[model samples]
Target chain A: SQQGEEDPQALSIQEGENATMNCSYKTSINNLQWYRQNSGRGLVHLILIRSNEREKHSGRLRVTLDTSKKSSSLLITASRAADTASYFCATDASRLWDDMRFGAGTRLTVKP
Target chain B: DTEVTQTPKHLVMGMTNKKSLKCEQHMGHRAMYWYKQKAKKPPELMFVYSYEKLSINESVPSRFSPECPNSSLLNLHLHALQPEDSALYLCASSLPGQGPSGNTIYFGEGSWLTVV
Candidate 1:
């Protein structure tokens, strides 16, 4: 079963704009990770934010986690057409075996 | 290397054919996983191997068997699969003994499968 649901199932924006995707999960988690997948390819790990961390940034990617709300948001600043892909959020829920559950994903298209 | 290598990037098999998908990781990760993904959908966990042991099976069918011979090699043996089972099969691995929340998981480029 899927654990997380990403809002804005699909988004399209002009280049240089900022794209934000939100995710909400049902259970408590140890950490939240965001990944990007190009068409027909493997997932690329973007950034990880632990439960205790409220925000993190990597390059143009900024991730904010709200443990109290069991939600997280990923922001891609200065988006480019190369950023076109599906973004997914995964949560561990502190499982011993590392069974990460992924969200439905947000399809972001940066129009150049 | 840090990559997960998956073999037969594309596969087309008959319903009665028996085929195997192989994955290898040299990053010394102890946990390996198999996930099935339909187009535009999130990948679903099918199996997990921790320390070369079968740790989690998400009630996958009997026809889909997973083998982890060692810490570096993982294989998914397929037999008598239906057309509906055709999808992108992904293999991923993470650091030794780390929970999903503990480390980043590296994914293969997914084997595209089609069952006729």
Candidate 2:
């Protein structure tokens, strides 16, 4: 499977705390993207890091990619209750085709 | 607010019924996709259409037929579906190419399908 694997299937944290999720994939990728999906909702693109880039940050989210390790991580700073959602890491394995595969995702809960 | 839009936010159909889930995007993205997501699971790629052409099928079952009428519109024609086929159908679009902007896929709110 081209899908990535995410650690900590579920995580619980309080507001003002930081929540981190890690992902590992098996194949070479052009880029890795992180998405957030609320329950029964559509996914929202969070950030994207290329294989050449090590780290990228967007607003309260930080994403790191290590192609050598075939792993990536996402960190949400100052988590809020509204931050509760499932975070997924997607890998674009084929450069010619849009064959993007997704990880199982990490369910995050932030308490007020 | 996502630029991609999907119709029939919720659908309930029988095994013998035939239905079509509609998706549209005005962003002028050359690539469109359909994804099936089960409860608590990640979205599975069902089909990909680039430049209004079927580029990848992902070996999807025949019961799920994907159609791209134009660059801005995509549809999934469902027929004789099993109960297991019930899932959240997501529609997405992206610019066709590499790089951050090209790889970034914009998804619709999704349609909830329930096969009875």
Chain B TM-score in each of the candidates = 0.96, 0.95
Error of 2 at B105 (Å): 0.3
User: In candidate 1, what are the lDDT values of residues A7-110, reduced to their tens digit?
Assistant: 99999999999999999999988788999999999998999888889999999999999988889999999999999999999988575537888999999999
Model 2 misplacement above 4 A: B99-102
Q: Which residue pairs in model 1 clash with each other?
A: A98-B100
Interface RMSD, per-candidate values to 1 decimal: 2.0, 2.1
Per-residue lDDT of model 2, residues B8-114, tens digit only: 99999999999999999998799999999999999999899989999888899999999999999999999999999999999999988764443988999999999
State how far residue A24 of model 1 sits from its true place (Å). 0.6
Error of 2 at B95 (Å): 0.3
> What interface root-mean-square deviation (Å) does model 2 yield?
2.1
Q: What TM-score does model 2 score on chain A?
A: 0.96
Q: Clash pairs of candidate 2?
A: none
**Candidate 1 segments whose C-alpha is farther than 4 A from its true place:** B99-101
Candidate 1 local lDDT, B37-91, one digit each (tens): 9999999989999899898899999999999999999999999999999999999
Interface DockQ of candidate 1 = 0.66
